[model samples]
Target: MQLTNLNMPVASLLACGNDPGVMTTEQAHAAMQLHLDCTVDRCLVRRRARTTLVEAGKCVLDDQAERL
Candidate 1:
């Protein structure tokens, strides 16, 4: 699993300065943490999606008649 790809957006948001919302450093850190956490959640969701697709494909193949 490539965690770095998932973290790129979080890192970019953290590196940005001059927040339009006037967020403090602490607030920014918290927001970045939240983003990282959400990214992890998304990765898990993607993994599950892939697993389901593979399982469905296998099921379809299993139900098909053998070709000579």
Candidate 2:
């Protein structure tokens, strides 16, 4: 997936800076570690927001079906 397309929390975790067009393998690992290490309550809001963003993206894609 494109780093630039990532939502705010995920992009921040990758630490690829403001305009992250690409990410290194180490950055990917660190981001995953951070995600795995965080406690559920601490990450709950972020997780919820990410879920909402994903659902919204799906809706956008589903719009094409409605158009047809």
Candidate 3:
């Protein structure tokens, strides 16, 4: 059994970008709702942004330990 149903109209609207000619305000809203309903995926690893900050602190601490 398929767990998800596809909305062709919404899919068409979403593909149209923000063009007011092809997609209207209501259609944009429907597209937004469809986007929000999609599942988000995350990997089990340290994010690069946070890792850089953490590694910077580690390096500073290592330098201080070497000095002492």
Candidate 4:
């Protein structure tokens, strides 16, 4: 997805910045046009968001397992 097409608000990135379950630096850079890391393969931020969600789900499952 194009950077402009993601349509995520700037506040969302700010809120998610400290969360490990959020997007990688590359994705965040793409989101806010910060150009923090330009060496990564140009991937759509939306795809990264989806991948982050999947990883976050796995983390939750792992935590639940520890609690059981």
RMSD of each predicted structure: 16.0, 11.2, 17.0, 10.4
Q: Backbone clashes per model, in order? A: 0, 0, 0, 0
Clashing pairs in 1: none
Pick out the ten consecutive residues of candidate 3 with the lowest summed lDDT: 40-49
Worst ten in a row by lDDT for model 1: 59-68
The TM-score between candidate 4 and the true structure equals 0.25
Worst 10 residues of 2 by lDDT: 14-23
Which segments of candidate 1 are over 4 A away from where they belong?
Answer: 1-20, 37-68
Comparison by TM-score, 3 against 4, better one? 3
Alpha-carbon lDDT, every model: 0.36, 0.41, 0.32, 0.42
What does candidate 1's lDDT look like per residue over 1-68, in tens digits?
A: 23343433434344333232433333334444444544423343322323333454531223332220
Query: In candidate 2, which residue pairs get closer than 3 Å at backbone N, Cα or C atoms, i.e. clash?
Result: none
* Model 3 lDDT per residue over 1-68, tens place: 11123323333433323222333333333443444543212211112212333344532335543343
> Which ranges of candidate 2 are over 4 A from the true structure?
1-11, 14-21, 37-68
Q: Residues 1-68, candidate 2: write the lDDT tens digits.
A: 54444444464563322332333444443343445655324554334333343454522325543342
What does candidate 1 score on TM?
Answer: 0.25
lDDT of 1: 0.36
CA lDDT of 22 in candidate 2? 39
